[model samples]
Target: MMSQYKSVFKDETKLDINYVPYKLPHRDRELRLLTEFFSFILHAPGKMAQRIVIAGDVGSGKTVLSQRFGMNATREAEKRGINLHYVHVNCREYRGSLFLILYHAVSVFHPSFPKRGYSAEELLQILLQVLDEQDAYVILTLDEFESLIEREGTEAVYKLTRLQETRVNKPQRLSLICVMRNLKILEKLDASTRSTLQSNVIHLEKYSKRQLVDILSDRVSLAFKPLTVPEDTVSLIADIASSEGGNARFGIELLWRAGKYADADDLNVVTPECVRKAASSIYAVMRKSEAAYLSLHEKLFLLGIARFFKESERAYASLAEAEQAYAVVCEEFNVKPRSHTQLWKYLRTLSAVGFVKTEVSENIGSRGRSTIIYLPRISAHELEKELTALLEKDV
Candidate 1:
């Protein structure tokens, strides 16, 4: 029998690094821009690193660009004999504790990394001491920076900003690249501090379809056999990414998934149709980070609804079936199942978070209507995987 996808599946468990681009697209422009911006700090005699903020919607390619800039900064610093201790950390992952982040910062530049028995303040002192001794400028890039305020409030944020205000007979020489997923990062800062951040705002816009197409096409050469990926693969991936709100990560992921499907079916050629089949699952998981923070009971409730609809194949699932399925998941997780009213409220929360769609439909015989919960896409397995990963991190 002829199979649809046979050739591309060398290893299903292959790491995703193969798909991630090492260098950013049109990255030289950003590198030059940031170089010029950092020049303001690097040239500032011992105390003038102005605050810079990077703003973009989720998946708009901010972090990747920032890292590329970070890499360039290190290269330039070395060329000019400028001492710089570069550190990159994602705040969302580190939002639970300021110490975890500082630990990461100290650990990056120091061989020992001071793993045992240091308070956050102690770690900061050690980091600054290293900086003073080395006469090094610090270029720290903090991604998902808004999470700091959301999770721990403003004490850390204000304190860190204060560090930038220090002067050795000049301005605070430390530079920071702060990334936020939303504009509210502006509101979180005081007026004087926001003014410093405003001077260096770099907005990473969503990728255009052509941009995503080019990205996927370029990677295809490195990732797959020549002429193996059909032309429509680019458009298929681009359309899905754009329709899902211009998510570059989503585009990269869909291409990865389509390759798998093609390989599994023993097809030598990757086609748009394969990507079409794979994108639903990709979209499902792309939004799971938002779901991860929901209460476990809420997750079980959503899981129950997802299982029911997945089994039923209809958009609208009966509350009765959903409740039963939910109960099963709660028992498996060893958590108490909530009542129907509480479950419905959970459904509303999920909808608000864009996990599921909901509608009201009348029963065949009953006078009143029941709430019908619908999956945002055909399957939410990816979503489940995302939430599970996030929960696992907390555990």
Candidate 2:
């Protein structure tokens, strides 16, 4: 029975989300900027600690870009006779503990290093000493760095940024590349700390449809058998992902899922229909669970937004229009409608939970700005159906 199953994947590991490709499409400019920013390390290995922040939306390739740059930078540094090491730690994994983060970085060099009985400052000293003895420099990339700021506050950043101050006139052995979803978290830091990072920040923009297509095509060639994934299937996955802020990760995930579906059916080729099946399965599960947690009014408000999208057939609806739709929904359900202020709060809650996406846009001819709202991942028609079922069941 197992032998009868046909396989379409050449190497499914290539489609793993965590797998970083050797070549990143549409990120050469950002990679170049990263190399130039950290070039000081090559010229003078321990001149001063270099730090830069990479900020972007989710699935914008910030983590992969930093990892790729670190790999290449270390190779280049070695060719020039610099003893450099790269250590990547996700703040979320460390739970934003300064001590654990420092310990992990140190353990990369000294795996036997004691995890207990040492303060964070002590660990820093030991790490520096180890680097000095080995004549080594480190490029530490802290991914999801905002988690640290949230848990430990700005002091975590302050400590890492001021590591050089701990040892005066010593070769600065550690360079930092802080990866975050966005730079808004920087607002919490003091001006001095912010300024240190503000000067050397790289922002990655979302991928376009064409860019996503190129990216998916590259992965297909590596992960799937030749000609198993058609251009139309790739284009369809790209179109779906591009709808949700051009997230390349989502496109890759869809491609992987579609391949699994094709293999399950013993089909040789992945079709556009497979992509659609994968998307529906993903969103249906997500929407049901997420909708269950919403309050009655929140569900009604979301249903209103969905109705607005379906009726107008537009990508976005203004806050005013959405509110009107909400009122109509309330009346249909024989429920009292909330005030504008209350609905505004609902909008915030919806966006925070990923149920809806809101953007502020300037009115072309008016002085006032308007909030435009839309569904990000799921379709309006599907949302309306789900919310209607939930709301009716509640009734």
Candidate 3:
């Protein structure tokens, strides 16, 4: 088994979602902005910490940049003898309720805090008490914070931001860096909470193709052996990522997957074709839990769409074409086909999860309207293969 295993990756974790590079490229301005905003913490230790919102699209480096600043702040505070600690939380993970969020945060300071038998208010008191005793400053970086606000309401956000103003002996101890995909979520917050965070929002723009190439080149050198990745292969992955909305994470994943493909085929160097293969199977990036939740007919519908697009060699196909192909797929597998309306519903579901792209075509149709559909990130052939394997496992 050991002899059979082969991989070009020197350290695969570099491709991980949690990996933070030592040096962040194309983000100097954002980092400088964060440093400037938080500079008061170092200049005046007891002064209230800044509350800021960081908004950006997925894979735009929001989490990593904020995290790097948090790390730097911790070190700088220690050098200045400031009683400061940085706690990072992904609100999506700790989002059972507001009580759960406070429990996790307070537990950082009070390790013995009970995991149960506490109300949200009680947990808040415990957290405040611990903060009062420690008399330390904290910068809480809440990532995917929109989920928390959406699920539990903005009560927690308002309380944390108002920590200083709410008390007579407020330690000026807490500040917030709430990371979100967009400020549009702010619409859901209480007007006061919305107004409080309105002034200090940092927006991270998506990376351009050239920036993505540079980002991937940096990771490739760090992740693979010298000469294992050719320069053109980097460009190919960058092009694919650019087409998919300039997500650097997608580009990095393509490079990692391409290398894995090369190694699996016993190739010496990653090639453009390997990148294409990687790009053709990008839906493999979907979380298994999400995939598991897909209904069997939904999966079959996707496989039909995949097979049609694979055969057509086009980025898109008509609904009529998809329906006809889907019926053929149903016949082949001895699976009963759903109505056209049901297939349309399945297409909508697939689109919601980023699996399929659907749009109204300008060309006139027999029915006077037609929707064109295609897989967004992967080729139909690859999707067919993946869906076939997935459905087989389900069986």
Candidate 4:
């Protein structure tokens, strides 16, 4: 069986979620605009850095472009003998508290900083003091920033934007780069903060089908050996991504998945069928962050649904059976199950997020009387593992 597998991936890590390609295709305009806007930080030290907002839809290249700007800014700062740093933090992971976000930002420079027992103000002061003492310039980027604003309110944004006013003896200069899905979150902030960010905003549009194809082609060259991923397969993945809102992340993920499918069949080249199979689970894997945020009972409920489908002969499972299965799972895991009404709410939540599909039974006799539930995009086994990992980690 080991010999039966023939892999096509040259470097699998190239397709990883954290991987940023050396060359970002179809994103030059955005990168160039950011560089021009942020030139002040590179040229002058101690000058008030610009607070720029990067707005875009999911997988629209905002994160990568901001990272590229950071890389170039670092290099340019070094050449000019400027003490500058760029720290990127995802707000979703630290959205629960403003202090946690500040701790993450400050810890980038001071690795010895304690993880707990510091107030939000204290963290900000520590960060300000360190940067002022070093005479340094820092650009702190918050990705998925809307999550932070929504969870912790705009106090964090207010303080950061008004950093110059809050400083005492030595003025501390800190810039902020906020990468969000859209400007809707800005409305939640105070009028003053909103006006400050309204000055510099870069919007990234979703990629067209052709643009996605170009972007995937670049990644394919880096991720797979030549000819391993055929042009037709790439086109198929592009079409899939385009249909799913031109999300380049989804496009590349499909490419990687298709490659794995081909390898599992001992094939040297990825095909359209492999692409389709890969897409079947894209939503599940892509929503890992959302899964991680689910409550314990909710995760168990999802796992129960997955197991029901995996064990049953049919592609779908009734809510009645799923609720019973969930009760069994809760017993095995030593968790008390929630009420049936609560479980239904969880089902609705999952369906809202595209994790599962809930529809009335279409059978002749039972039609419109009962609802059937099924995993819409991801496989049962894959979801089980994902939920298991999330549950085990919280333990």
Candidate 5:
């Protein structure tokens, strides 16, 4: 039976389930995006690398997709003798203020951002001068860029865009590729500022089971040697990812753990059972690692929601009631309590991380409308257990 199974694939015994990434699935859409942005820079003396935003939910392949675009564009430009320089930064980590980011932005061109030590305006001026001197365009792909507006406000971003219009011998030929988590945040910008930049946008949806299945199958082709993966095993990963709201990233992650699970068991083939066991074993453990980072108060708040859910048998609770439960949880944990607004902030972060789901309720209560929140991707009981395991101290 095993020998027969081995004959099914072109070769057998090797299969990689990790997300090494490929263009096979999104080739047309991806190139369409690349060329559209490249079109502005490929011809124009100024603005060859156009400003564009690619935004999507977490784990929806935003980072991977943008990385591919940057790499592919660089290679294509090199082949065609188009001078191009590309760099990527996750704006969330570098959030200090606008000038700080601008200072760091210089390093994207060279390691000497501090060596430039120029004011924000001077830094940008020098960068524009560098682009002109090199006769090449710089494409900066900033991921999680929305965090910048939240942390440093819109003015810093607006200032960066303004550099494009600065004229030296010619128009400041700077191209910006900003990756945002939420495109709706664009409304927060002034109409003029929004119009000059954000000329194009690409929105990515969470992966569906079918798309994830294809993604995993392709990844296996590249990462592993041959046909170690069973068909049902691959399908099982699809089901887990679909239940988790179609995150291709999660699908690849689960598959990677599944392979490890099989190897640990000394199994020859990765079976459906091995993959299913991996869901609760390896995947759940990593989930705990994330849960570990939450502040104690945040954990207690989440625990309150979970306890409420477990006891009430309802997926959601009003803020007033949740607040009461949160207080009780805080008392039990012997931790300082946070205000309702603080808890709400934590909830928003948790929801963004896929542990919770939130929806706006129009006029559901006295305060116009509040967000109705629930733990969709995770269960309250499991969340409580996971949080309990991660914390060495109380709460």
Candidate 6:
């Protein structure tokens, strides 16, 4: 039985979601900006604290980008005789507790550090004192920082941003890279914290299909055996992920799942069928459950959006276009179409539930402003099929 087992993965760990590649394709500019922004720590350590915000949507490479930069920056600092440490704290895991966040950072160096009995401020001071005695510095990355603000409110932001104020006349020992899905969360912060953070912000846009292809290709080379994954399979995965806001994570997940399917089936190579199976397994159930809650008009409205994408083969469609398609769908269903106001309400509701994404476009020629809609996680073609089957059953 052991001899019959066939595997295609050269190093499975390479496909791990948390694994940060040494080279990040299509993120050179962002990485360069990070290097420049934090260069102060290497050139003049302990002179001043640094803080920057990294904003991007899900799967926009925020966490990996920061980790990559931190890894490289620490190595460079070490070469220059600076003892710089990199600490990445996921705010979601700590539930945005200020004390817990600080404790985690300290525990990285002092594993025996007590977990309780210290206020946030006191923990912060202790952390700083430890760093001072060791003559070390840290580049602290707060991932999912919005969680911190949501749970602890603006006070958490204020405390982290104003760390330098606590140790006046001493060398700054901590710099911060706050990562969030988007900077809109900053609106809840106090003016001082917002202004300080807003001054240096790095925005990472979603990866394009070609970019995702390159990324997946790189991972495949390291994760799978030679010639096991063909170009067609990689392209299919990229195509599927591109429909979902060009999410690289989704693309990578598909690739990994495809490989797993190949291995489980004792196949020598990963095929397009494996990718399809992977995609369906990942989101089909969730999508169905979510769509099941929609009312009839809501389903019809979503079906219209899906049909618009199917017909236009475009990434985005105008609100007017979607409404027009929706009207057609309503006619086909033998139901009266909702007014424009009601359709707008449907759009909002669908967007809130993650069925569709919308943005206001200003450059619509004669149309001053128009709402642009696109599917975020599911492919339009697949969504169309799903909604159509459900609508027919309802009828």
Clashes of each: 8, 0, 0, 0, 2, 0
Q: Name the candidate, 2 or 6, with the larger TM-score value.
A: 6
The deviation in Å at residue 376 for candidate 1 is: 12
Write down the lDDT of every candidate, Cα atoms only: 0.68, 0.86, 0.80, 0.81, 0.67, 0.87
- The lDDT ranking, best first, is 6, 2, 4, 3, 1, 5
Worst 10 residues of 1 by lDDT: 11-20
Candidate 4 local Cα displacement, residue 272, angstroms: 0.8
lDDT of 5 at 330: 80
- The C-alpha stretches of model 2 lying farther than 4 A from their native spots are 1-3, 285-395
Q: Write one digit per residue (lDDT tens) for candidate 4, span 17-109.
A: 788777788899888898888877766566566889999888898898889889888888998898889888888988546788888878787
User: Which residue pairs does candidate 4 place in steric collision?
Assistant: none
Rank by TM-score (best first)? 6, 2, 3, 4, 1, 5
Task: Judging by TM-score, tell me the better candidate of 2 and 3.
Answer: 2
lDDT of 3 by residue, 12-67 (tens): 78887788887889998999999999998898866666888999888889999998
338 Cα displacement, candidate 6 (Å): 31
Score residue 51 of candidate 1 by CA lDDT: 62
State candidate 3's TM-score. Answer: 0.71
Q: How close is candidate 5 to the true structure, as a TM-score?
A: 0.64
- Top lDDT hit: 6
Models 1 onward score TM values of 0.65, 0.73, 0.71, 0.70, 0.64, 0.74
CA error at residue 42 for candidate 3, angstroms: 1.5
1-395 in candidate 5: lDDT tens per residue?
56432222332232332222447464458557766767655555453336787877776777777777777777777877877777777777777445566556566667754553456667767777776777777777778888777776667677777764546457545677778878887777887778866677778777776787887797667554477776666766776676677777677777676677667767666655455556656444336667777777777777787677657645356777677788988887677789878988988877777665566666745668876655544545566777766554643
Query: Which candidate, 1 or 5, would have the higher lDDT against the true structure?
Result: 1
lDDT of candidate model 6 versus the reference: 0.87
Whose lDDT is higher: candidate 2's or candidate 6's? 6
